[model samples]
Target: MVHLPNTPTREREIKLSFLSIMDIWSWICELPNLDDWSESPVFELVSSGQADQDGSTQSVHLRADRTSGSESEAAVIFTVCLQGFPPLNAEKPLWVSEKCHVSRENPFLPLIVQLVQEIIALSPNAPNSTCPRAQLQKLKPEPIAWVMDSHSLESFSTFFNLVFILRLFWLCACDAPNEAGSLYFQSLLPSALEIVSSSPLPVLRTFLVTVGIDTELCFMRTLGYVVAKLCIFRELGVGLQVLVPPPCRSPGFSYSTEAHGVWALKGYASMMTMMKVASSDGLKPQIPRLDAKESVLKYALAHQQLEALVQLEYSVAFNDGFIQVLARIDNIRLHVAKLGFKNQNDEAEYGEEKHFPSRVRIWVGPEVGATYVGGLSLSRSTGNAEKEVEIQKIVKGHFQNLKLSKGKAVARTSTKTKMKNWRMDQEAEGNGAIFDAVLYDNATGQEVATGRPYGETSDDPIHGLRRRYVGANRPFTKTGSVVLAGDEYGEEVGWKLSKEMEGSVLKWRIGGEFWVSYWPNQAKTSFFETRYVEWCDEVDLPLIPGKMIV
Candidate 1:
């Protein structure tokens, strides 16, 4: 435990009261591990009005014990007696009551009920024994109902445990196994949602990101379990406009850092699953889903964005408001994921670019061994469909320019070939090497043209010109005829030429989507690219923050 300095006037008072509480518990309990409970059940009983008739009496007695350590033990003993057995209630010990007086506003009773039920369900007949972890699966309804109704942020028991209690409450509210319990749980969902949304506790919010990369809560696993249970809140319009709060400005491992990643991924997955279920059951909601973007997808690729990904990756982040950055990154990722593929891969293919004039090479799936289907798709003109017509006009103009370039190249090639053939004829009587002739519209530059003469003789032929010429601009022509027929006198005119061109067709096969693909195109690898540039731009590179991933 980190020791904090005692500076304020009330600091000593706090220390004294805390020590007295410990002493009281030490004297009254002797069952299991004493260290396990930092507090006494006796204190709980008295504070709730089950023991003390008046709150002031308990405070005074606790106060007196601080001033008189061992020297006035008798006086301290007397005060305890006065508090525990006021003459009017001497028959009852200081901590006895027929009914619990825990305030309905206090979160303690409901949390206690949850903890107790968790213990009972796991431990069964063992009244005083701690429950085993395996049996404490999901939370029970009684406690969730109590907490939902109470909805107070006051930490009556372990301030740390309040998050867990609320989390369990939300989980039951969303996923109670039975209708009897679910109906009651559903009724409390709105209240629970309100409590979480309005509460400013960082722990409470991070409790929704089960990954616990956010360091606010002391115990990682406990906080994670709490966060993993927010499926119910998500279903209740927990979009950016309603659920995520403003950024937190505090330092240290806060919830906002890791939460954004977990929430976006889980929530998106859940939403998709629910959509599938609703489609099958005919119960879909009318709410429109936002498309996921590459930038947001980058965030969900959890391991990569952890510090910036969550926050620990930056040394400067330790200076201030790092939690806010974490929250921003998270919300952005969530928003993108919510948008679905529309936000990520929605760019329009324009003009001849859709046909991929240049041969393209793409890997299949995420692995190399996964074989790819490769073929070329050509652009073609449509007669009257408005959009396709406009696109074809643009493509035709571009193809005309390409034809000119191709024609010029062919003219140059033809001249070179004729000279070589003339030299060969003079040297060897033109019997051995015959020059095949063809024409292409290679004009002013490398671009092909509107039209060209093409042919292949049985002898020497260049690779690009020898095969069938599929118009780079209009490969799939509406006329459905071969573009350039070979002058070969084969039985099947240009069919063999077409067969030879098959290998070069550019194929566009679909790949499985990545979270990054849901955001901006370059977002996956570039979210933190500028940060790195800034870091390197500094005269000295900072020590890789708190902990480096590797």
Candidate 2:
């Protein structure tokens, strides 16, 4: 049977062993006092007897009791199971073989200190540096020569928590703008690059991948800012290997279905910010190369996350090249064809495939004519050759009778309907489809205002427009027009032109509405104003030129 040390004897021995590591103790004591940390329960060291013939085989367990908290709370924080005592003549007199188990919630103070020390070591001579070495050197001398010694379960969880804290601090420091606030960050970056490039802690890597798509916009914003700064400083390349380490870089990176959904939203947001910054700075946007594996589109579809797919569409709008990337995925065409248009509420709209309206509609109206001549439809097609042929036929049919003057088509859709005084309908009516229409200058192909169908309770037309036109890669010009079409005479469709005012205000007017009237701004953005006024005196509509097509 193994003998165990008495409580007082074990306590004395543990104290002696802990006190011998003067530098580590000093570092712990010097940690800045955080409010929550100060209030946390201190660790209580306990000694237990192991199943060994020698009484020397003892283990040390570190625990912290919950402060009147839930019973589910963890009581033990850490454990050090000593295998055996070192030989008396061993170079390291106190060295012992041991196994450590740390609580998932316990913060590994030693590892954190080591990371800070590594950073300080990298930049020992930085101006006004409060390096860890300098701080430790000022500590009181002890008899024992202190050496930094290198060393999970309930322990794995504790280690994960500790790693999380380390990553959070590092990320936060990198984001801090003030020099003093970023002192540690500035010192740590070089080493951070190496750590990330080399063997990053698995727990830390997992944390980043899993939470990379967190709902907290601030976290992503901050992470993106830091990433941009790193890129600007030439510390990181377009690969973004730091945020996505090699292990998690694989297409089959371990992520739950929920994680994929979160990534579909937050990951896209982060990537957009990164791409925008890179574009503005003239740096090559490092779009991740997922050619060998299933693309994000596949992940989104597998999870049945249509909203995520819609978000992807919005991302592609700002970056034209993304469309090409999307096109290369074989599954994309099949999936998109199978999945019809999603409405504002993300509900799928399924009907006759031919009647599945295009995501974008191009309307052409002559400056001199009362009626629109013809419209063009553009959408992702499963068959490119078939789509091209169909497009050519439609263009030929529409432009058959148009005469070009200064590269502009002077044409009308039809001459049968005569222009007349019309009033807007007071009650809002459904357009039957989301208005994802765009007006373009036929001569220059420059886009006008993108149309968004609005309901009576709808607000923020700009946002609505974004949702409708998910792949609009261009910014809205300063001045644009929104055209509305109605089914009835004197209650028809027309354009409302807007001019940019001082402080970015948009001044809108009913620029010769055939049947459409000015929509009121119910929310912050423009909405379709279907309501018309009482019919006024008749005005002569512009007649189609004799040579112009019907």
Candidate 3:
């Protein structure tokens, strides 16, 4: 059994060998604060031949751990540094003695390997960074392992590179082996969360600028990374809510210059796609509605913007990435389609699929009710008191032809033949079907409106007697007499006035509707004014024959 040295007293001036000074100097240099001292006496002795052991053993007495009572702790403070000192003047072994060797491999080698592997596996979860390298690697096999075998479960480790440390942290943080592993890394989870929620914007931007990288792409990627980490990671989900503060309204931003806008836009686009993927399992943020369809469309479109930018910026004009992005966007569009808001045109009566009752015309007099001419009775249902008046106006106009009923009653004309023929041709030619019905009145010599079978049109401009409205399927046909119909009476009167007076003109009337009338009157007054002016010149107010609004 080996004997260890006694602990020195606090104020003792104990004699020290040169090697003992070296031991003290080595320990001091390892101190974080004293690492810069290159000219100490211990360093000088090592540099020169004065303290060289030259294969001869030398005893180095060290005065250390004067305050420590524990032998194990005192050995750490005083003895280990000099443990490697070699003998002085001991004759070196002959170089050709390999044939006389007892064994080819050392038995301690396997122990060292196992020790190192254990250290690496456990050190990631260690509370402190410090670990004993010699005990793990068995660098000098003579000294006993510092801790007892049972306690040596606290494996040895060394400093690792930042990237490796981060990788290891993430790899283990995602899943733990046992209760101890889980408990040990529980403290580390919050630190990772803090980093995930932290804004690297300031530093990242500056770094990109210094490296001459595209700032827009950098910013977008940085933002995307933050969003992904916060939104998806189990540890960071709650903390992220605190980090990214929600804006009260949309902060509309536009680039004044093109310097690096394309790259930035691409990053935005990529992140959005990533967001969809990470939150695929019902963990995504709820996007609020904004002013225009284009605003949200722009957000969706931001991903594609980068593709365009790449083509424009690099002049490569390749499209593989763009095609993949388009496929992703198509998926997003399909999701938006289910919301039913983006498919406004699909619900429309004309121009596309007929979603409502079509060509619902009824001459309402004392004989017909409001439901036949206008729509289902609002007065009998959830009717607003104010909308009742508007419904009444529509009912009155529907039956104004009561006086002309006995004279030359207009025959209700339907486009059954034309619609049927069109459908037949569509089926035969493999073209999409046209479900819109064109209602006409032979006496009035004009088409009433375009409608789907299920949709109704109060008055569509499809039959208007104007140059722009002059198509083959137009509402109006040439008539011998200009007798006005119910809907066209005002325009006919204006037309008669214009013909009789050379300077008279007619214009379309436009005004507020029931729901948003107050808002339009307050904020959108200018739009109403401009429309009124155009209507006045074109139809209401008289215009000189040679003069026009343009």
Candidate 4:
């Protein structure tokens, strides 16, 4: 603690409260005495229930004491209350819960405290402080590291908000190892998804990485674990999904920022995956997985998007959203290993997915030793899907048609009949380098290789990717208002109700069957999943506002 403001010299009273966090900030910013750290704001928080029997309202007053001498004291108090870090000030009294036990020290405490202290020092309100070079290096992985040479406390506050979001992320898995609906998890996930979905992609790309690698590392490990637990919520139709762009590593770091669109990847071990596969015999990884890296590389090379000889490996990423990459890889190199497992030329494929372990470069493009060189991936697509059991969910949608007496419902589906693909064949990449970089001046220093003639039509095989799902869209609709693929169709059922039941409540249940199939085109495994979905709804004769099924 470098410094703390003296005793409260001024007090600001907030007229409204009850934990309106964002609103409270607005109130604080608008305060006439805002610049004076000496001013402690008092907020009035009312109870959710009615007034007491005496006709007096039940309420509490919360005082925000920022930058006070009590900061360290408060930090310790909160840490103990949350049963977080067992502070050195253990002499302080606590009202421990009988049902809960602080059995062990929380490993998360040290990091969070460090982050908070760093955030406090960098915050816009703090007095001048020096950020040493060593600390800056420790804080980063890249372009952001250099940017932080100057401080911006305003943005630091955004990260501070994400602090609890990250906390709930890890704690939910801890509290309910088997369910995504734990108190902390279920409540926070929707809000998280909303923010991710609504925010502009540029904003997410710029700041999310700034939140620190701690968040990425923490959540990355929690990913498989959390996803494993999400099937528990399937019955409620609530799901959390994160789609990391399948990446292929070039063998080394990206050379220049122009290749910002390029991606390099590193493999990580998940604690959940490790524990799930652990057995009494010892540490044996008897798990099944889909190697997105191998699949992507194979797809790219098979279609001639990348040279057949340049090495590539699959990498799991921790970064921003959907990325637009240069569809071709024309230049590259590999340094075969001599001492490692790969150096021993262990080309055997193991595990259920039959994937070879990943390796880095030994000799790269410029005649380095055995290795693979490439850019890093930072794109992550995350969204949350929640279905609330509505009184009229069946007839509630943008395409709803159920109405007055005679109504129609459209259901679209597909079939794996392998309909003939009448479309033109997708062409591969042109005879060109992915970047505008001039590798050589006289062209004598450059190593050249023969490739298929460049195409004039499309980036299909490489630029836009394999176009897997489009081939699967089928069963064209016959009589629905909307269009559907030849293999997909919509069944509209004309519904009628008794006139007397109009003013009252009317309920109906419709059942439907659908099939989802995956072929082993580039996938390591394929299977058919038959899902039977039911649509149920209840409606009053006179439609309600926001409830009209049309």
TM-score of each: 0.22, 0.24, 0.19, 0.28
Worst 10 residues of 2 by lDDT: 325-334
For candidate 2, write residues 1-550 as lDDT tens digits: 0011111222222221222221222332333333234443332222223333444433222222223333343232222122233332111111111211133322343344333333222221211222233333322212101211111222223222232223433323433222212222222332333333333234433333432232112222223333324333333232222322321111111111112111111111111111111111122147733332212222111111001011111100112211110101001100111121122111222111100111121111223332222222223222222221111112223354667423343433422322211111221112111112223322233332222234323333232223221234322211111212322212213222221111121111111111111122222322222111110111111122222111
- State each candidate's clash count: 50, 17, 21, 37
Tens-digit per-residue lDDT, 13-65, candidate 4? 21222234224223333433324646555533212133334454322222433
lDDT of 1 at 13: 15
List runs of model 3 lying over 4 Å from the truth: 1-168, 171-200, 209-550
Backbone collision tally, model 1: 50
Better of 1 and 2 by lDDT: 2
By TM-score, the best candidate is 4
Candidate 2 Cα RMSD (Å):
26.9
What's the true lDDT of residue 210 in model 2?
Answer: 36
Query: What is candidate 3's lDDT per residue for 8-77, written digit by digit as tens?
Result: 1222221222232223323322332222324322211111112333432222222222222333322112
Q: How well does candidate 4 score on lDDT at residue 132?
A: 27
List residue ranges in candidate 4 displaced over 4 A.
1-160, 171-183, 200-204, 207-327, 330-550
Better of 1 and 3 by lDDT: 1
